[model samples]
Target: MDPELLTIVVMNVMNTTRLVLHYFMSCETENDSVVPALLAAMETNNSRLLLAFTEQLHAVDRRYWARETSTEWWDRIVMHVWDDEQWLQNFRMRKSTFLELCAELAPALRRKDTRMRAALTVEKRVAIAVWKLATPDCYRSVAKQFGVGKSTVGAVVMQVCRAINRLLLRRTVTLGNVQEIIDGFEAMGFPNCGGAIDGTHIPILAPDHLAREYINRKGYFSMVLQALVDHRGRFTDINAGRSGKVHDAHIFQNTGLYRKLHSGTFFPDQKIPMGDVEMPIVILGDPAYPLLPWLMKPYTGKLDSSKERFNNRLSRCRMTVERAFGRLKGRWRCLFGRLDLDEENIPMVIAACCILHNICEVKGEKFPQEWSAEVERLAADFEQPDTRAIRGAQCVAIRIREALKEHFDHDSQ
Candidate 1:
């Protein structure tokens, strides 16, 4: 075997062992309101039982892999249970309701003999277990964090995503805030602006030989996350596909969002006509997108026409999408780097964040001050130009500036 290959194998084995050990013996820290409730279901002397289970983990490791490592490894595991006693006491969720819900969904959820079975009572325990996995760490890390086996960590993630996806099936569009988002754009100098359209890169390690295909000029392998925002910087549509190597135009053509303007009924038995009535759904783009009639790009040429003025203001409004992506990836530094999962799981997790972001925005929830500040700070970096990657990047930049010559270009009319 190649020396590099041998090194990787050895490193993987060492990391695996450390993560598994971490799972068993990590000391607890503070829990948010949710973690405590998750811990509440444990019976008396649960810690003592947990410690004994850690001991049994050694036996299971020996029997399964015949690689007798260390019981001392178990001593290294950490738990955060002591951080919030009040939270545990006050946490409320009907254990019966959860069990009944679980019974309806998957009866095999908590077989006492199963490794994934909860040490605590609240159904939120399972949900929390699922949540700890938002980071793309190995199951060993997640297992270590949640005090369960690696296999259990994997199962919890899959189950939670599928379960949540199904339960949240009736997600209506957030057009309720559409007017507010549009209002934000109007204030920012873009009127009647529907949303900003842009793409983001999510880093993930290469999975196989074809992994090279996913790598981009950014010096990392990534998947492009494309989003369409409403006038107020609220997300209206998101599609995660196409590796970083694919151009923005290719992604736009494939997305099929334009079809919505052409098809579908509005109310009972009222069939909408199919004639090409150009109801303008402004998809504000930089020159990276095509100059189609419906989708507007910034103007780069001399400001002589109504189109030039329109592009100018359109560019300014569309900027919010770029800033939003900057805020999201910069605040979540984990997203700025590589993810651990295969490509398939990557999209699911990315989709979950997009969904959660809209949900949180709708709920008016905010992250800590530090993250908020980071978002504002790193935002300028996103607007910086790349002269090399895009041949017409400079010309497009010119077009955007020209397009912004006036707000809405009504002077031409």
Candidate 2:
């Protein structure tokens, strides 16, 4: 046994002794007749009484002092995630990117110096956590790969995820200056287009109480990842954790991004002057999002040649979000399967993935061929119905689509 573990066991025994004495002292006042029987049992080293008391203490003590095995899975597999390019991509990031993340996250994840038993290194803990997000493997499978207990794997996953949420999410996924947004979209041939908006469902184990709430139109339980992606395939804003049952329009309304866009805070109050009217910068969306001055959704139902041309152009721009989501789930394969976590915890994991996606984009991380394969796989399993019924701001939607239609028609001529 490790010296530290032995010391912990001795300390636990001593604490148990004090607790037993306190129980005896309390029993003397409450039940005088029972005290003699308890004393007799203790004196005799009664197996039943001692077993009951020691069993409860042992459960906690064993967990606290659980020894790390000598399997060296850290060196064999975890470290390989950083050293090999193929393995690094399989782990959902590049080598330099993973090390940068470790540097950013290490301070909070590191164990205190005063701990008696040594804890896993910060890099090891983070690698374990990322491997969980990057693959569909469960805790037991992951634990076996890492030579750690399942519960330890679970704890490390959650802890590293929480750190990512607190330290990285807001900083990495952000809406930058309005000019940057405009420039990014304009470079793609859609003038005044700020970004693209869309929603995707991340599969998760259904919650016990509200299982029905998570069932989407496709009949699978999932959590929705409603996002705004820039022209560069980076998420500028994300609203995760909505029930899969919710429509994209409803999810959009619930986000702070919606409030800002609706209130004219997202973009400059200045509007581009057309022949008869002025229009604010707009975000391109499919028919699922409500149309507003600052938001534009394509026309529904039958369309004329001009309208079809406009939709095509708009879709080309809107494909930014689709490709961004594709890369996101491709890089983080855990989103491909039903995440084995509590319902409340599913969002944190998704949010952390999004944050990492943006970091990879910033770092110029290329998606491997495997990422493209995952994208194709996901496209087949995830199907969404067109919810294009005119819900709100129909007049604005029509006028904007008409303007863009005329612009494209003239450009072609």
Q: Please tell me which predicted candidate would have the highest lDDT against the true structure.
A: 2
Error of 1 at 150 (Å): 2.4
Residue lDDT tens for model 1, 1-413: 34444446555655665565455445565644544444453332355554655565554524244333232322232122322332221211123322444443353333354574334322434444334433335567756554556675666665654554454322622344545665677687764445777887777788675877786666567788888876545567777857877777677668756455324211112211112222233447776776543455665556566665565567677878876675455323446446666677777666655654554455444444655576556444333222122224344334433443433454444
Q: What is the model-wide C-alpha lDDT for candidate 1? A: 0.52
Off by over 4 Å in 2: 1-68, 76-84, 113-116, 385-388
Cα deviation at 336, candidate 1, in Å, is 2.5
Per model, how many backbone clashes are there? Answer: 24, 0
Q: What range of 10 consecutive residues in model 2 has the weakest lDDT sum? A: 56-65
Return the TM-score for candidate 2, rounded to 2 decimals: 0.81
Q: Where in model 1 is the C-alpha error above 4 Å? A: 1-138, 169-184, 261-279, 301-312, 330-334, 372-413
Model 1 scores worst on lDDT over the 10 consecutive residues at 265-274
TM-scores for all candidates: the values are: 0.58, 0.81
- Please write out the lDDT profile of model 2 over residues 271-373, one tens digit for every residue: 7854355678889888887777678777777898877877888898999999999899888888888888988899999999999889988888878786788
Model 1 residue 132 lDDT score: 47
Winning model by TM-score? 2
lDDT of 2 at 380: 78
